[model samples]
Target chain A: MRITQGAFSFLPDLTDEQISRQVQYCLGKGWAVNIEFTDDPHPRNNFWEMWGLPMFDLRDAAGVMMELNECRKVYGDRYIRMSAFDSSHGWESLRLSFIVNRPKDEPGFRLERHEVDGRNIRYTTTSYAVDRPEGQRYR
Target chain B: MDLDVVPMTGNVNLREELEAVGIEEILTQLDRELIGLKPVKTRIREIASLLLIERIRKRMGLTSEVPTLHMSFTGNPGTGKTTVALRIASILHRLGFVRRGQVVSVTRDELVGQYIGHTAPKTKEILKKAMGGVLFIDEAYYLHRPDNERDYGQEAIEILLQVMESQREDLVVILAGYGDRMEKFFGSNPGFRSRIAHHIDFPDYADDELLAIAELMLGDMNYRFSAAAREAFVRYITLRKAQPLFSNARSIRNALDRMRLRQASRLVADLDRVLSAEDIMSLEASDVLASRVFANGSSPANYG
Candidate 1:
């Protein structure tokens, strides 16, 4: 998967060794990680220049799932964010959905949307109870 | 394009040639070489190792692979920060981190073009030079401002952020400068801060370390120091040790060059004497006195 992830923090707060190890660890588990520049904020100062590399941007969704399985073996239950395409009518249109993995809820999280690529996207933004089908573990 | 397939079984020591050439020899020969910063070295090594692993796993069909990584270096002047960065580009190429590993270093002034609407192409031109390898920005702190500055360092920063994520598979970005100055630099722009996951620090060299480094410079040039000359050099260094502008290896070098010229002048009348290597190598009091080692402006900060 061509995976990308990003957020903000002063680059110096995290040593180069720490970040390289994390990138290595992520790659070792089958995730392609790119630490590139991003316009994120500093930890202490809300207004610092975005000087460091951002996060991972995954290209293929199904490929990401395979890697996510591998990731589970290493990261255990640690929260991971996933983005995948939702297509209809044989690739007529496509959009992406975001989800978090939980032990007891749905086997995986899926979001329904009017249009998958942009704003009309819906998500399970928080962890809460939902009604399940007859044999569902936790819907 | 590949019709013939061959089977391989043995491990090859890929860097035997580089190792044979000698790290010190290569360092000395380079147009610019910053010396002595172990922490920065170790960090670059870590990044190189990670890049190597990614390549191996991808070949075996076991990983999602990307081409290059983005990293930042933080340190003061004369800390050998830029020198290490260039070495990193070389090592990364050897290890297959980036395809070319050509390091294109620039400062904010080079990146942020003057006037409105001109900065994007300028930044892109720099990136073009840096394509297939590393783009190293010295004094990256200057790129971020409070939005009223005439320099388009911020616009360049934003455009760079988008390009970094888009073209990350082939390019690496390294932002470098003094530690405290960088903190203040980052404090000015939030958009420029978020993407960096790693930071490396280059600390200042100790006095004795700098002196030893100076001695090494002379040794490399096939010259040796006499007892008196060595003492005089050390005493001279001690006298200026507290000066805010004293250079590390570089200042010591300027001193030696001046001494060499002084010795040449003294030996002009004795050219027929057939001097031994020792006689020529051992620097004397006259050389030091005539040299500008005692000059007022012989410091690292004084140069650049």
Candidate 2:
């Protein structure tokens, strides 16, 4: 199963038009939109590689969509997401985040279990796609 | 007591009185109502002071970020965890933090949905109701069950984490359960662990504290224990404290309820005779002993 973790994971994946609407909503709130992509979709992986600096001065939704398209062209096989950052008082973190793209085939994680002492087990989750090299993953 | 009849100058004092009943007064009230758990009280006071100072700083334009109010209360059942969470809500409201000083107590069943595509909406609904107040999740460790592959509790927890972050300013989430189990629950969810700012441990009440709590409950109900009954209660609480399913203050409440039943039956047995006020209000030693026997499933051979 895909590790669905984000704002709108339970709903159907957003198309480019739906993504553009969300970007417009974020831009309407005076928030900066940024694109991010990563192979490791761990829930705690908060720092996804930034496609570029946050589109702070870009007020138009078309600007955000253009950048998002460029990011998808390069990292289309990886999980790409869009996040809106609110630099307002009392909140400096990402206010909204959602996955925009996923690999054609998502190879989910494998739960690695190790037996410790008596009746104790330690488990590690590793993404199966990451076992292959960067370009070969999700091929 | 009539506000209309009072002089205009009296309104000043009334306003002062209203202002006086703020966060500090709530803390004082919490201290008065709870019997023991000194450390728990102290931690709550610390949280109140921190929030108070933050408000002061924000007013002075010295700070911009609001402090996280999410907490974890680890202890056994009936050790005043829910009560403290309620008090925390009032404190936050009075201090101008949250809009409402209410506590919505829930367990795993209330947050987690039964099937797929149901957990997020259920959890979000609960969070929406808990906004501008405290969401007190009792036995929160049950929300994470790793052994059950079909359990949707983790989905509920994931929704909770997102809301806890997004709604930090208006809502406070208090996760409470047994100490060992809560520790294990935190161990499994590292993201959840990092978000919790305060961890208050409600230690089990000492024997004397339980007795005090029992007496307080009885007094509130216009009843008292006789001298011998007091001794009987102390013994009962001590024995029950060591047994399983012994929820400190809750056990006392149950025991008191049973004793009241026994006292009523005993009084009814002498229906023809005129009874004094003391006879009606006082619980006898036999009443306490009977409650103990009822709870333990047998007569205590050593109590006699």
Candidate 3:
């Protein structure tokens, strides 16, 4: 099963048009659109490598799409997401984030369990995709 | 010299009264009113201070994201969980976090529906009423019954999680129940656990604190225990603390009510005599003993 972590994971995958519309919505709200990709999709992995600087001056959705396309060209098999950063007074975090790309063959995760004292068991989940080095994760 | 009639001064500090009431005042009130649970009070203060700083940061145009306000209050019944939740609502309101400082308290009966299609609307309706304020769910562990497969409580919990996440800005949820049961409930629902930003444990009050709480309750009613009656109350509370259904303050309130009833009857019995003010206001040892006799099926000699 695909690692459903980001927003709109329960919904169907967004088409190019839907992604453009979402980018437009974020740009309309004066938020900067940014692209990030990661081979490790751990739920606690908050720091995904940024494709480039946030498109702060780009007011058009086309500019965001161009950048997203460039990011996909290099890390097509990695998890790529579009995030809108709100630098307003009350919010400096991502206002909106959703997965826009994922590898075709998701290796999923392995749940490792260690039996502790008595009935206690500690469990750790590790993504199998992380076993591979960067740029060769999918292959 | 009527001991029952305590005089109240009309003098008020103008500066203190005119000062903007803030979270500090609410915390002070909470500390003053609550009998014990020092840890709970400290945690609440920490949360309030963080919220205050967040509000200031927002005004300064600094980085400010409202942290999750949902909390878990684990303790026994009548330990003032609901009372603390009410005060927390006031604190959040005074800090400009919530619109209204009201608390809508509910149990599983109100949230879980009887039929399959009934839970969502029922829970949503309660959430709507609790919006712009605090939603206090007492005995929240009852909302999830894994033993019963047909139960609709899980549905209510799901709806609650959804609202707690989506309407976090407008609503604050406090889940309260027995400590172990609440721990189990959180273990079963990781989503619920993740949303709870604060975990406040309301410890059972000590014997001295319970005694103080009893005095406070009686004082509010203009009632006082005679010297011997006070000793009897301490003994009675110590004994009652070990019994079943020993709700800390609630049991004390019940015991006090029974004593008052006994005192009223005792006073009526001596109505022919001109009773002194103290006699009418005071609870004698006999009255306290009689209340205990009525509560436990034991003989009065056993109390003696």
Candidate 4:
């Protein structure tokens, strides 16, 4: 039931050293790192709430890690992911992304399958948090 | 914080990995549900094996860059290209290649634009919708307009190429069309051909395969042909194959629809007759023979 939207989801929630390693890897490739968090980790939910802005000038991973720590203090009950965008020629989208924070409860997702036309089954995954009203999904 | 890095190399088993990911189940279902694409099925199996090995390697802590999964499907109409694309999406999702397996099918019109500066946003919108899944472009060759000097398709193509490279781990784009025209398209657009990993050709179904498809379609509808009608349908298939625009399964489906209409007429023609379940479900040979396709000697205008 893990939200497998990014790298290292199949493994484990990364420690500080592992998170910094990934950030360093992205920074080494000249990618702009950004942090985002959301209570809804639905499969199609691409645009999570941005923590501040894309850190384009931060060359060191520790600086990004310090900013990440600040964001974690504010939204510790949400799923936060570190996404890096590469604006170089020929590739202008997210180059690297991985979840760096998750809720303590982590109530997971349920897949809904609809039988469409002949032998076609459409699948949709919805977060279990939607059962609660907005602004009160998590503690 | 300390992380646990286990020495997990020697304990990995490919068989257990395959079962854990249910790769075999997906392939088996692909074979069981689809008919007469033996070559396509085999190609899919090979790709599945490659992906399965990569998965096993990942379990053994040998992570590597995600391989490009973009593909091109070339074949005639009604050859199950879209169906196979759907199946491949499921395979990729199961193998942990993509986060979601939903297929967003589009064509040149959906991606291209009429006015200047409109194509990029149009294509980007579609790409955003297709992120985390597959973007299936049907008749993808139409995106290029060599004859037109001011076509917007080129802009769309550029955006597609960038996303195909940048967001490849999250999104897969599949270009589908007729074999020869697709070849010509790839010849002109080398960028597309270079990025695509697999080029699967869906062969036209043989007459026997088409017949099996016909029976399968009829069976699904809870309808059956009378003894003479079965032979009549076989003849219908032969005749239909010779006609122009002979789309394999699609033409057969249309033919069955017309026959069902004819059966309905035959039943309603007798207003007071007691109707049995067999009478309602059975299609007689006369119903199939009434089509303009069966008229011989002279060329009928509506032969379709």
Candidate 5:
């Protein structure tokens, strides 16, 4: 999906690196995003080109957000944000943004714990609010 | 084979009962997806618990006051209030709080009926439809306005109030609409306000959550987006974030449909001959974002 200031024009041939860079650029510029996706309204057969592109239909805003989720899962480390107007409410236009939050560890990593008490100073609690050593929860 | 056979003693066929009433099925379906509304989920669970307890009390033949069935669901459109109402109906039936588990959903027009004497039977008919389960009234605020001279919305409200009071044990009534509007409607009618005890608010889905929803929808349809396409879509979304008319999941679905449709149409354009599976399967990025579609559509430059 390619976005422009004027109208809905798509550059279908953009690559992963290009998309990633674009996302980075948009974030750097502090712009809002309207996520448009291929599965919205209806599914497209030509997903390769249509999968995660922005569109210019005020009616398709929901569809775009749905697609952005897919993009995050697929692209791994890439993300973007943009700003636009919503015509649904007939109200003043506002700016919105989208940014992807990814996990730090892709697979899994091991961490060493201190058993200073000798009898083992480890306890487990299901309540996430419980106080514990920073890295002890996963164990 | 061992000659000793063990007999099952407990009368509760939990799995069978669940299967018989479609509880497990609806649960599975609903559990598979829930977007950003944790408070709503907790309330639903609590209501479900209340219904379960009510059922147990009934089974023991204890003469206790019937559990209150009134609720006020506050949220914007596209919020899952309607969906949650339907599920609540099912859960009620499976737990034996109601007999049929049917949901008779209506708006003001449908409930108020047409003429003076006509309102009674019309409201009755709707109640009959909702008998044994839930009566979900969408945009219920419209019912409070007796001020509208020609409108029968007031009559419908009166009828609904009566039905809600009388049918407390048999049917569950849910009045849903915009939060602020509902509040005003309640303020206008003390009787209606007193009956409703539980209120749940559904919040709007954030951008990341919306993105996740889009992905889920596409993945379910077997569509995979390329990196460029995803970024492009996100870029568009970010540009529109501050706009008041933010599209929810429903809007996102519509956009995806149009994008895919445009892509599919491209393959058929050049074909004077039959199109192949391969040709039909792939959508080029340009095909999805055709300039013609957005020619008169929204743009950042003209958005202000």
Candidate 6:
């Protein structure tokens, strides 16, 4: 199954033009756009390795697209995502995020459940790919 | 098209679309932000109207005709070409013409390559990056070289032409350069010239306008010129205009930057005297006079 993790992941994989449009949308809203990638597809992995410095001073999507192209050249198999941060007082955090690239052969997550006292149960979600060492997990 | 609010009636509601997009607010902001460019602003308004009417016609079930938005911005440096291009991008986005209205600015070096078989990928990469927005090519004239047979700039141009025609809806390519050289470029390369629909020439700012720009810059930097210092700046403008390589408003900014440096040194020289807030903020006539342009000879001490 597809990870279905981001804004447009359910739809078709965005073409370069479509990705450029999304980047432009983020820049249009005056958000600080940044890119990240990781072989580990854990749901709680909030600190994926940043591709470059967060593009705060750029108003043009072309720069972000260029950097995205560069990042894809290296990390084509890893899951790469684009995120945007808004600096306004009320919304001083990430406003939008979308997975722009994904590795082939997505090893779906494994959900393990344990029955606790009084018929109560708890579940833990773990990524199958993480069985391999960190960097070698995806390929 | 963001025109869903407008009722789909037989008649066109031009005013509603204009208000919904807030084109007038962008135009007014353009006017207030830039110092003086009456004609440029008018042309932008005309383009906005053209796009607006095109949208209205489409809403009324007219033929779907996409007006090609490829344009040329010819002007001297520091004449607000980039600024105007950004505004045009915003306007294009607001009007629903382009998907994303950000400008990806590039120069000849960025597009053209040094050796054989390199220019195509470089140009294509840039085009991919600029997709769904404006691709602003500064000094676009440099892309054509009639004298050098081995030049790969023509390769870049050919690829650009193909994409400019094929991806007309997805991207807007804006060529910018000096007025005369751009004319020469258009003359030699008819294929390139024929693709451009709008040619906007940005004029050099007058001396008074440059002074106003300097004042505005100073204000933004939290510095103010003293009464006599303003008079000195007027003289400085006249002298700098006569000097070589004097870019209109850009040169004024450079001069003011140096003046600030001089003010810092002057303030530090008299360290014993307690400095007031006014002294920290105000630029004196001596600060303005200390430029290398004012001195008749290029002496080392006057460099301060």
TM-score of each: 0.56, 0.63, 0.63, 0.68, 0.57, 0.69
The per-prediction CA RMSD against the true structure, in angstroms, equals 18.0, 18.4, 20.7, 17.4, 32.1, 8.6
| lDDT of each residue in B5-81, candidate 5, tens digit only | 13333365545534554555655567668767778877776776565445444544553577777888998776778
Cα lDDT tens digits for candidate 6, B197-291: 99998988988889899999999999999999999999999988877777887878888999999999999999899988999999999999978
Candidate 6 yields a Cα-based lDDT of 0.85
Q: Could you tell me the TM-score of candidate 2? A: 0.63
Q: Please give the DockQ score of every candidate, comma-separated.
A: 0.02, 0.02, 0.01, 0.02, 0.01, 0.09
A-chain TM-score in candidate 4? Answer: 0.88
Regarding lDDT, does 3 or 6 come out ahead? Answer: 6
On DockQ, the candidate that comes out on top is 6
Regions more than 4 Å wrong, model 3: A1-139, B1-21, B293-304
- Screening candidate 4 with a backbone cut-off below 3 angstroms (N, C-alpha, C), the clashing residue pairs are none
For model 5 chain A, where is the 10-residue window of minimal lDDT? A37-46
Q: Pick the candidate with the highest TM-score.
A: 6
Q: What's candidate 4's DockQ score? A: 0.02
- For model 4, how does the per-residue alpha-carbon lDDT over A1-139 read when each residue is reduced to its tens digit? 5677788998878999899889878977989998899888887887799986687744446546766887889998888999999999999999888999987886888889999998999988778887898657777
**Chain A TM-score of each candidate structure, as shown:** 0.23, 0.93, 0.94, 0.88, 0.27, 0.92
For model 3 the TM-score comes to: 0.63
Q: Give the B-chain TM-score of model 2.
A: 0.89
Evaluate candidate 3 and give its CAPRI docking class based on DockQ: incorrect
Off by over 4 Å in 5: A1-139, B1-28, B61-63, B146-150, B272-304
Residues A1-139 of candidate 2: C-alpha lDDT, one tens digit per residue: 6769778888888888889779878977989888898987767677789986677744346556656776888888889998999999999989999999988888788899999999899999888887987677866
Clashes by residue pair, model 6: none
